[model samples]
Target: MAIIKLSETKLQELKEVCKSFNNDKGELINVLHKAQSIFGYLPAEVQEVIAKELNVSVAHVYGVVTFYSFFTMTPKGEHPISVCLGTACYVRGAEKVLEEFRRILKIQVGQTTPDGKFSLSCLRCVGACGLAPVVMVGEKVYGRVSPDGVKDIVAEYRN
Candidate 1:
């Protein structure tokens, strides 16, 4: 795969973050967190730089990244849309709601829109069974979402 090169300023900034962490290999997760915050996502090239700085194998870094569900290698859109797919949600027609989002957004789960305005993903549960079919855009949550309500929800973010 081709490397995504980092600019000089970004490279220097990432180095500073490592320096702040003392470059201890045990702080790999913390380093990765700061790196992701700086770069938006943890790409292969960034991971390579981190591995070298932290004095650990790239494989080890990759292992830790993949182990955590919160870590993502791809960039997310400004509005990250998530649909709940827990047992309660599934039973309450969340599948149809998810399909509507995919149909309208034209992107599959884990994919961001070409314009980088929105992303689609599925989560197991949000601990809101009372509102089983819950959809989240950023931190805001919409409960009892239905397929018909999808267009309005998508439109609200169009601007």
Candidate 2:
């Protein structure tokens, strides 16, 4: 992963977020969430700032960031794709669907495309078993996805 320099403005914004939570160690998770929102991903530099602001160790902040699937140390694409690998989706051919995405996007799970247009990942469930074989692009959910339909899904955001 490439190292990114955190801008002063964004650093101030992160500090303000921690301040909003009184910089309480108990609110570490909350602070992390808000920090992620500001910086997109929690890089080591951001984590260091957060640790100092919260009066905690950098290890503690890193532990929480890595512990939660919601947090990411690397940046995501403009449109992130998450495939549901839960029982329902898996049994329904989620793996094939995932492969189709890999082929079309030319990127594997947890990787963003070279053009920075899309990123692919897998999750346990999306709470939409009724709509099995689910694929989420950003906040929009695509249900009943099949290998053949992957191209069309990618096309939706190509422009």
Best prediction by TM-score: 2
Q: Which 10 residues in a row give candidate 1 its minimum summed lDDT?
A: 1-10
Q: Report the C-alpha lDDT of model 2 over 1-159, residue by residue, as the tens digit.
A: 466778989998999998999989999999989888897788899999989998999999899999998999877889989999999999999999999999999898999898889999999998999999999999999999999999999999999
Q: Supply candidate 1's per-residue lDDT for 54.
A: 92
Could you give candidate 1's per-residue lDDT for residues 55-156 as a string of tens digits?
A: 999999999999998889988889999999999999999999999999999999999999999999999999998997999999999999999999999999
Off by over 4 Å in 2: 1-9
In model 2, which residue pairs have backbone atoms overlapping below 3 Å? none
Relative to the unseen true structure, what is the C-alpha lDDT of residue 53 in candidate 1, on a scale of 0 to 100? 95
Supply the global lDDT for candidate 1: 0.92
TM agreement with the true structure for every prediction: 0.83, 0.86
